[model samples]
Target: MKTKKYTLLLILASLFVGCEDYLDKIDNIEALTELDIFTDVNLAEDYLDAGYTYLITETTAKSNQPDILSGLVMSDEGYPGRYNNSVQERYQSYANGDYLFLMDLNLGVQQRDTPNLAVRYSESWKGIRVVNTFLENVDLIENADEETINGLVGQAYFLRAFYYHLLTKRHGGVIYLTENLDLNSDLARVRESYESNLENILIDLEQAIDLLPVNWTAGNIGRPTKGAAMALKSRVTLFAASPLANTNNDPQKWVDAATAASDLINYASQNGLYQLIDASDAINLDVGHGGADLFVSEPEKLNNYRKVFVGPGKSKVLPQEAIFMEVNDNTIGNGGLVPLPRTYLTSGYDIVKGNFNPMNIGATANFVEKFETKNGLAIEDDPSYNDQEPFINRDPRFYNAILYDGVPWIVTDSAPLNTSGVADLAVINENGVLGVDLHDPTSPANQLWRVRNSTGYRIRKWVPNGFFLRNCCNAEEDFYVNNMIFRMSEIYLNYAEAANEAYGPAGKAPGQSLSSLDAVNVIRNRVGMPNVNGMYTGSTSTLRERIRNERAIEFCFEAMRYDDIRRWKIAHLEENKKVEFLEMRWQGGVSAIYPTGFSFENVEQVNLKKTFIEKNYWWPIPSSELEAVPDFGQTDNW
Candidate 1:
């Protein structure tokens, strides 16, 4: 038995068949020891790969309650649809704080039936331990050159900081650990202050930036780059400066965040690491499935915005707009959930038993109201916004992001790959018993008040059109959708937000070449939306509202809304209201063939009511951790 503080026994055993078998094969293959692992560059790299494996990209139906989905569902952005009883209860827990679950390492295991909103504290601790173990042993690797050593070691540092940031953000001032702990090591530790925790995180990120290269070769895609570290620093500082962390709402923290974001922007620009993808160049019409005229009319508009999320559509390679993302080759590391149209669409598509169901999950009606008109005016401000015809004359992003009633929908076999005249349209409206056929309730287009969309709208941001429809029909089929973690557009918004906070909307910071308006306009111009500077002039507070609105519009359903509202310290205001859903009244019957449009007359509240108490700003510290280490303290109000 080894007496070293850390042991590689269990981790190594997990990588192989059995511990005894691994030991027996060591003579034929390679010796397995801490010294052996450290001395061998390949073994050291394997350890880092283990560390990276825990990094989650998307919240799928299987692990139903990641913060990416929960955050939005808990916030005003999403409405719970056809989830199971546990998921429904989880949504209720978020709203009223009625039932809270303890965090466990095996929380999201398929065997476990209960839904868990919290990330496993134990898993996060394990991740931290893995990173610390790497940092401690990396120096012993002599086979690799200095640059290679630094690059790998720097990733470890960045990952350590990343896990710590997640912990601090979820449960403020968690027990901070750097060294790898073993059975004999002390486990009890007091919680650190949020400021101190952020400082430690920033220190690791700074080291990562200093050591990591700006860009890696094509072979090493998805590895954290220097820009990723810098971007992370900006995100951390931004959250730290928010009302939740900064009780006084410190002005200097805003400057700090602004400076950090500016550092990334300046570095990426100087190094030529990334740039905003031009709308024209971003469009790729080579879809796997779509009607002939799908890309024929206004192809530039349909293909431009969605291509960034799914890579340049045809080639499906990472666009320059991507700062850091998980690389997927369709066969492995891809999400099993297909985001099927039945969940959102009310069209006549076949639903094979065990293959697909109309599992409802759509955007909230309130979220759809945030989009601006094409003429740079809000729906409320623009006289052109017709409540009778709400879908028309809206932002182009509306078409890019949503598949509303009357919009083109090309289901499998409904349209060939090249036919372009027009595909079938979605029929998802029924006012009371008039529009729906009570006699034929099983019909696809008939109104489904029970299992259909809670909101009148369906999500279209991640859903690809045309050829993608045929390929992504069921979970068994593979859909290589890259779960985007961070993008350059988010950086632009972060800078605009921090810059506006640091130095009012119109004013520029010391090193800034453009004001907050210019930064926002860059994103707007990409989508062909009218510039913000030409709109109604307002104070810094007004511009602040516009910036927040822009973020909501640009990043809807991308899993950033929950944190955005909370960090802004407005969760209590926004979250407590009842979730609203748009109910349209079709002039023609639901079974009627083709219709021009429907009227948005019945916008009603959902059954669920969200309640955000003062305690909700920070998640509750899991009872398991609190009980295991008595010295560990609970988050306030838990």
Candidate 2:
């Protein structure tokens, strides 16, 4: 097992994964060999620590990255940067490869060419390699006991599954690895078929389930447990056997997926993992999550929700539902990595009365409206719905997952105001201004709550305000969040999809399972919405549609939207704005200019009926990977 006490000399030797020119090779600070990193426990710990780096590194996802990649879709209207020609043209399905990574949340757009697959792919692979190394040599831990070795092994398997899951969503058919690599295999790992790759990922997950222990102790809460592994197995199986993964539109695959998802839900209560919390009483804005102390404070259940992310009252970045999370252990003394909150954790933590932020930095309105109503109906199809009442008392998951206007949310212990730059009893709004209305605590912050005839609503998903303080720093502004790679809620969603697909939605198998409706209805009831009934039985086609929308709203901003869309083969047909790359350069004057038009052609227009073909289902293989081997073929549409 890699200890946290390895020497710096050995730690520097593991960088041979990539080489450099003579000058850079001799002076490169990143160059490290296995011997350099594995010579001691600290170095060994560093080898396995790559997982933490990927999960916590905020570098690739700072500022608007999450918003652009996950939020900005065709849902919201009048969002910024949606007026350009390419975005203007492809309002439906925009997969412009040229603008790969240009993500700006406030601006409401990103260039499709702005993506950087190479760097991300490399980062993910690095974590996987570390995990592999740990799994292989964990028995060598002379310092720690056998139970410690078991725990370390479980963590490695969890990491491999988690990293592979990321790659599966990013680029389906990613190569799967099991054992630690030799020098040659690390450099030229063989790719596997999409089906084979997914199967192998599940295999890793099963092993993880057996190896992990449930209900970990203090200092180990964020680590993987048996429940986590089981939950993930359900998630991966649901995807592989779904409309997108199977692609052949097979029903049996859907059944398998549903069964897998159900397994996790079946075990939820036993694990003390997560549960719904009723907040019908917390509207006073004084009691947080309907709990004691601060009004908007996170209740125990809500705390479980926040356990995966770093925030208030939590010292070690532990999330309640985090099966496999990272540790931003600021308590780790000077040798630890925390300069300040600005760079250490970019989304500066502010503990005001407001329990959560409802800003739609990723503003996709139509997409957000996909959740089912209390009666398991959707705003888009509710028979009794008017535009104004489309979202009324729809479902409880809606509130837990997001913030809606007029819905009771949390405020601060006291209104804070900042006469100068310093915060005091008078609270400054998120806009960095003084109290806009001392008389009105419920009034929306002017910057985010701009009214369109006093009726327009935005989103507040991740922003939670309370008695919290953040120390951001540029050195590692990247915060580590325990990605919810698996959860009980997902099991329900997966069951809905796979059940409908396998049983033809009318079959009694899944419909007869009260857990199907019960699972989702539990979520709906939490939002004070009526349960979806009558339609839960018989005829799977429409029910499938309902679940699809549920996922869209439920999993938004969790980095699963694109993956879901691709699997369903619906991206092209999606009536949202197409991404464009205009090289938005300042004309050195008062305006901006398109130094170039969008780099891709045939951008799809939104709300228009055009078929997004199956070939567009998978992302194009990286050109560099193709260059690595003469035979590797890039997916079509590159």
- Using lDDT as the measure, the top candidate is 1
Give the range where candidate 2 is weakest over 10 consecutive residues by summed lDDT. Answer: 594-603
Tell me, by TM-score, which candidate is best.
Answer: 1
Model 2: per-residue lDDT, tens digit, 1-638?
11122121111222223221111333434555444444445545545655556542212342212222222332222122222223324433333433222211112334332222333455566677567666666555556555666666777887887778767665677667676434444344455677887778877877778778876888556666887788777777777876667767666776677777666655665556655445333222222222242222243434433333334433344344344433334432223333121111112212211212111232334444555554457655667543433334444444444433223333322332322322111122334432222222344554332111111222334434322222222122222333445545566667767766665543424324544555555554544445555664445655666667667766655555656766676666645334221111122232122111111112222433334455545555544445554354555565
Deviation (Å) of 199 in candidate 2:
2.3
Off by over 4 Å in 2: 1-43, 56-68, 71-118, 179-190, 278-362, 371-376, 380-384, 388-457, 465-485, 503-514, 576-613
Clashes of each: 9, 88
**Model 1 stretches with alpha carbons more than 4 Å out:** 1-31, 57-69, 102-117, 280-299, 311-316, 330-360, 413-452, 466-480, 533-537, 574-576, 588-597
lDDT of 2 at 116: 28
Span of 10 residues, lowest total lDDT, candidate 1:
10-19
Per-model root-mean-square deviation over C-alphas: 6.5, 11.6
Give the Cα error of residue 244 in candidate 2, in Å.
Answer: 2.0
Error of 1 at 284 (Å): 17
